[model samples]
Target: MVKPVNVGIVGCGAISAAYTTTIARLAGLRLTAVADLDAARARATAEANGTRALSVAELLADPDVDIVLNLTIPAAHADVALAAIAAGKDVYGEKPLATTKAEALQVLQAADTAGARLGCAPDTVLGTGVQTARWYVDNGLIGRPVAATAIMNHPGHERWHPNPDFYYTPGGGPLFDMGPYYITALITLLGPVSKVIGAASRTRSERTIVTGPRAGTTVPVTTDSHVTGILIHDSGALSTLVMSFDSAATRAPNIELHGEQATLHLPDPNHFDGEIHAHPVGGTWTSLPTRAGYQDAARGYGLADLTTTPPTQLPRTSAALALHVLDIMESLLTSTTTGQATALTTTCDRPPPVPLGPLEPRTE
Candidate 1:
């Protein structure tokens, strides 16, 4: 039997709960410690998960931690990842990799120099929902991919979140916040993007908080609330993207891929699983069977998948892919400003598809 990898998590925020729960259930991973800027929160999380709570420095230095599961906010992702790599530990971090391409590049470089493996989230792709779609695409069910559309629209997060000020800030807008899921899924299904054209808008300068103690208080908007982009893939396929916080609702399927023979309506990339429907040129829509991806997967399955990967292999959620996803997003925003199509500076091969099965055999 393979030994379980030890995981030490930093950042005991809401996302940490998901990781802790996932790590507990995965046979190949063990949660050994947790840390946060808020020591009390860390202690509470540690106690809840039956793990130790240590200072960030202590957690990074601990020899028992084989991987640092970084759940820090966007601003801190690169710093935490670099520190973990410097400490000779592999890292798996939450999405976007970093707020800026430069910071993400730095983290990638540091990990390379340290010979540490680095992975990032939006691992939802590894689940059946998106992976099943990849299976069909890879099998040529779509028959010569032509184009695709990805749409994510909602009013905003302030409606429920207590302190939603960050949503209106530079790194908190819809594109940076939710675009990762859609864009990453697009890349996964279609392949890497080569160039992009973009346009964006901000509906209002200020928004009122609708719930929590901060209800009625207004937060300033510093970022675009509606972002649209045209991505030209290396395969000559084009993907249209719409990520918005300005819309009250949208009835559009989360994503759709058009090909020579049919169009595939994919489930939400934000979720682990859902129904995928296909419409042929002369036939009615039909559901595709769940044919790929980790069964009953969730947030941290990517990390678990990383633990089981051979040392010389890149995990499906490798940092290189995350960095390319980040670069695509950042470049889109830059294109919105420059009013010119932007060529991507980075790219990654499509991650290998997950075959239909559980991540590992269930223990009786």
Candidate 2:
């Protein structure tokens, strides 16, 4: 049998929980150690995940760590990932891979030079919600996908997050902060983006925290808080997307793919579970499940909870999607500022999704 991979996490922040919790429940992977600028936070996360606390240098230098998971904010992702590469460890980083495209490419290049693998997140595409949607589009359930839309909105994270200030920093705007998930999902369901145009602006210059330890504190918006963009996928499908921090919650669908014969309803980009509902050419609808709920929970929790099935998920979620989304966002911003469409260049190769399965009842 092949040995499990020993993974260390390089950031101990609010978002790290999602990664650590998932790692704790997986096989073929182990939570080897955790590192953070704040030693206490690293210790806490390390202990919680049954690992050790180390400084960034120590963690990277640890011989046992096969992969380093980078969950730092946008500004820190590239630096930490570069260090991991220098340490001869594979890396999985959270998105926007970097605040800029150049930095993202640098990280990718470093990984290549060091002979270390890189994985990035939003990886939402691997979730049943997206995989199921991909299957529908590929199978012609949604025939000749013509256009699609993906949307995400938040008033700002200050309302709930203990430290939401980063959401307003250089990399904190709606386009970078919450854009990756939906964008990655769109790319996966459709294909690589060939060109993009965007309109972006900051609705408010500053935001006040409504609730949290920092309640009443305020932060300035360093980037646009809202963005509307158009993308032309390589497959010739046009995609429109809206991301914002100024809108109140509404019933806007996460994604809707129009086709010559049918329409597809995709699930939320932030999660992996949902049914892909299809509207037939005759206007009738049917729902498809890529995997039952059991399949989703198993993958989200890591494959350890699974028993009956063979591996049904692609190993591309946690970092690969993040990197791809980072690349796409960089291109869009460049396209917007330069008033010209930009081709999203990339080298991340995700494993093909698990083979499509019978449309098992989603409720099961």
The sequence of per-residue lDDT tens digits that candidate 1 reaches over residues 103-151 is 9999999999899999999899999999999899999898999999999
- The list of candidate 2 runs beyond 4 A from truth reads 291-294, 297-324, 345-351, 356-364
- Listed in order, each prediction's TM-score against the native is 0.97, 0.88
**Model 2: colliding residue pairs:** 119-319, 119-320, 120-319, 120-320, 120-321, 121-318, 121-319, 121-321, 121-322
Error of 1 at 349 (Å): 0.8
lDDT to native, each model: 0.93, 0.73
Clashing pairs in 1: none
Identify the candidate with maximal TM-score. 1
Candidate 2: 10-residue stretch with minimal lDDT: 299-308
Give the root-mean-square deviation of each candidate in angstroms.
1.8, 4.9
Q: lDDT value for candidate 2?
A: 0.73
Off by over 4 Å in 1: 361-364
